[model samples]
Target chain A: MTVAIQLGIIVGYLLLALAIGLVAYRLTDRTAEDFYLASRTVGTIVLLFTTFATLLSAFTFFAGPNVAYEQGPEWVLVMGLMDGIIFAILWYVIGYKQWLLGRQYEYVTLGEMLGDRFASRRLRGLVAGVSLLWLFPYVMLQQVGAGTALQALTEGTVPYAVGAGLITAFMILYVVVAGFRGIAWTDTLQGAFMLVTTWIALVWVLAVVGGPSAASSALEAEAAHHLALGSDFYTVQWMLSTAITIGFGVAMFPQVNQRFFAAGSKKVLKRSFALWPLLCVLLFVPSFLLGAWARGLDVAIPEGENVLPVILAEYTPVWFAALVIAGAMAAMMSSSDSMLLSGSSYFTRDLYRPFVDTDLSARREDLLARIGVVGFATASFLASLWNPATLFELGDAAFSGFAQLALPVMVALYWRKTTRAGITAGILASQVFYLSSLFTSIVPSTYAGWTAGLVGMGLGLVVTVAVSLLTTPAPDERRAIYFDGLEAD
Target chain B: MSRPALWGWIAVAIGLSALTIPWFLWGDATLVAGVPLWLWWHVGWMGLASLVFWLFARRFWGLGIESDSDSSGGSPGSGSRVDAGGERR
Candidate 1:
């Protein structure tokens, strides 16, 4: 019965999303600009919800809460407080700058922007290749989360492969059907689902444990250490590094960076970011509280499984658990859908059209992006079934890898002397150091109280600046590609 | 927003971000109303961040992107129907 209700709610939600996606597609102008960026006219409300949904994925639903449950609630500060402010700042620094350039050049992808500015096909290929590389793990992470959550919610009634495949199939349909227009519409729905259900889940769980005071006392008695700071796990370094990695990394995610171009006007972008920190607070608090409070309850979480489903199933009513789990599925779908959509743009526009066929027509390019969506989603679904690493591990590596690109991209945007070689070298060197953390211990993942990604980001910034100063400027004609029209009023 | 004022707000944002992690309360596990004091600090600090961001939004919404573009690019965000590598008309 529980499985039936869960399946029913989930299937119903998916159908509603599909219908919405199909309807949103009617608004598409069939032009590349309209398809990829919704004609760059997205307003404030939809923009906020889509971005919120896109950013809060399985990590927010499963990994973040699990961290709070097992370790402590200090995970909140890293994600909620630190990342919130940092990302708002980055949305301005990196995103706004990109928005300016994107407006002038009508750029749809970072690869397009960077590659054009430097006048290097290799740089375009490099930027697109790096994004797709890191994005693969993130896509796989979403699939894994979806499959695992469903499996847990239904108590194995729904197989992991089936759950993962279901979302993949649905994503391909909707993403190919509507593009960013469809995506923004469904993301608004999913974002609301996530926020509403997470808050209700917290309240439900907290009520079951009596109340905040009682739960706090229970934690104090059973897990007093969770309430306090000074632990090695939630240390200043761990919190700071994790926050920095995820915060900076987000701006470089193709899906998000693309939204920087999709904003209708600067007002839309400014309003969305201005409200971002508060939104983070709303969703994160309840989600983390569920995990932290679960530690005080009688929830039995087997090793390597997410604590959220277990808490929902054991504590909340069966119907409510099913609803919230569907909400978790909502979070994962919103995230993966955006990933596949933007990844398609990267693959089709940045890689295929540029390298494979410069003369590729817009209609064919659009068709290829649809095909890319199906292909990429299938690969991720298969990888989820394989389930290589834990959620946190995969998520962290992806974050660190993405973080390496942010600084180089920033330099390309703001600095006039930025050379192709300098940006390329910076990205490559930083990623080399970052990737070493996983495969080898020589370059520790965290050193001197900094994450490998944080240190790597710093390293990339330094290399980019130093190399830019050392390299000769691009010729005037080439420089005019980006810098020609800029003068303050 | 003027150049100096924009930079000043950026500095203020930086200051708030630096203090967000509760460096002072690392060892202090004091709970207010059964919630961790540090967590409470985050809640309050977030309100301040929103205010700062809101104020910044109201003042510097333009980020100077509107007035700085070259006239050759047509108009800003017209979705100029050109390829990324194609020349801006």
Candidate 2:
């Protein structure tokens, strides 16, 4: 009976999500821009919540608590407070320029704007290629989270493969039918649900663990190391690097970049970002605290992603457990749909339309985007079923890859001397060094507190600047058109 | 939204990150309001971040007067087809 109830709750939530997609479909126009970009009509509340929910992915739902469970409360520093501030700044820094350029050129994808700016179709393709490469793992992270959450919630009755398959199928349909408008609406709902339920879970856990004072004392007695940042893993250098990489990565994620263009107005975008840190605190602090409290309660969590389920199932009521699991699944699905949409946009708009057929009609382009969505989701789902690595490891690798692009992007936007060759070289150097560090032992992933990704970013910056000085600048016409009205009055 | 003001916020963000995360300050055996001192310190900073971001957003973002540009090549002096705010003419 309990298992059935839990599964029913999850199914009900998924259905509600699909219904929103249908409503979005009815409202959507036939244009490719409407399908992929939601006609650029998203308001402040929807924009804030969609961006918020998309940013809080399965990794935050699963891996965040896992780290806190293993390390201590300091995990909050990495994703919660530090990340919150860093990302708010980045949104202002990177997103403002992106929005201006996107509006000026009526661009539907970042690649389109970038290619035009550099007068290099190859550079555009490279950006899309790099984004797709890293995005694959992140898309798979959601499948893994959904599959594991269902399997655990049903006590293995549903199975991991089935759980993952259900999410992928639903998300593909959702993205295909609803487009960006539906995504924003559903994300707002799911984001609010997850945030509220997480707080409720926190309060419930504090009560069950004999109150906040007792929980704190229990942790201090049992796991004092988790309380501080001096642990081997939480070295100053490691913390700084992790925060920097993830901050930059969040700003560069294609889905997030696209959201900058979805804002109905600049005021809407600014208001959303202004409130972002508060939302981060509300969502992340509770999850980390729940993890720390698990240590106090002596929960045995071999897999960190299982922290939420194991604790909720054991300590809380059956209904509460089911609701929380549904919320976690919501976080995973919301993130997955956005990634699928963005990845397909990159493939269809950036790669396919440009290289294969320059004259593809808007209707045909929409069809191709839907096809790309299915293809990409299937690939990611298959990868998730293989279960190659833990969520934390895969997420870290993917984030580092995106972080490497952040510097090049900033330079391309703000620096007029940035040449196509210099930007291309910068991206290549970063990827080569970063990818090599992952596979080989010649360089450690982290040494003296700096991550390979951070080192790669530094190298990429130096190479980019040097190559720019050595190469000829972009055409005077190109520079003038790109930067013409972008300056603040 | 002057260049120096923008740089100031960046400095504050980095400085706060450095001061908040290291073990020398809030990492010890202290608890406030039944939470670790470090955890509370972060909570405090989240508030500060909200304020700073709000101020930055109002003054700095999207301040340029909207201009019209054609879809053709984004070339300057082309006939205007849409304004800078991204709306169609």
* Each candidate's DockQ: 0.30, 0.32
Candidate 1 lDDT tens digits, A1-489: 767888999899988988998798887877677778897888888999999999888888888889998899988888875468888888887777777677777799999988888888888888899999999989998988888887777788888888788878888888989899999998998898788888888787777778888888887777888988758788777788888888888888888889888877666776788788889888877889778878887667899888888888788788888888888888888988999989989998889988889998888787888899999999877877776578888888898789999998877766767887789889888988888877897888778877888999999999988887888865631655555553211
Pairs clashing within candidate 2? none
Query: Against the true structure, what is each candidate's TM-score?
Result: 0.93, 0.93
Please, what are the lDDT tens digits per residue for candidate 2 over residues A1-489?
A: 999889889889989998989999999988788887798878888988999898888889878887887788777878864468777777767776777667768887777887888888898899999999999989998898888878777878989999889889989989988888999899999999999999999999888878888888888788877765557877777887888888888888888878977877766766888888888888888998898778878777764347888899888998889998898889888888999999999999899988999999999998898889999999999999887478888889988899999898788777878888898999999988899899898767876669998999898898888898899965632765556666322
Best by lDDT: 1
Q: Local distance difference test, per candidate?
A: 0.81, 0.81
Error of 1 at A225 (Å): 1.3
Badly placed stretches (over 4 Å) of model 2 are: A302-305, A474-477, A487-489, B1-3, B20-26, B62-89
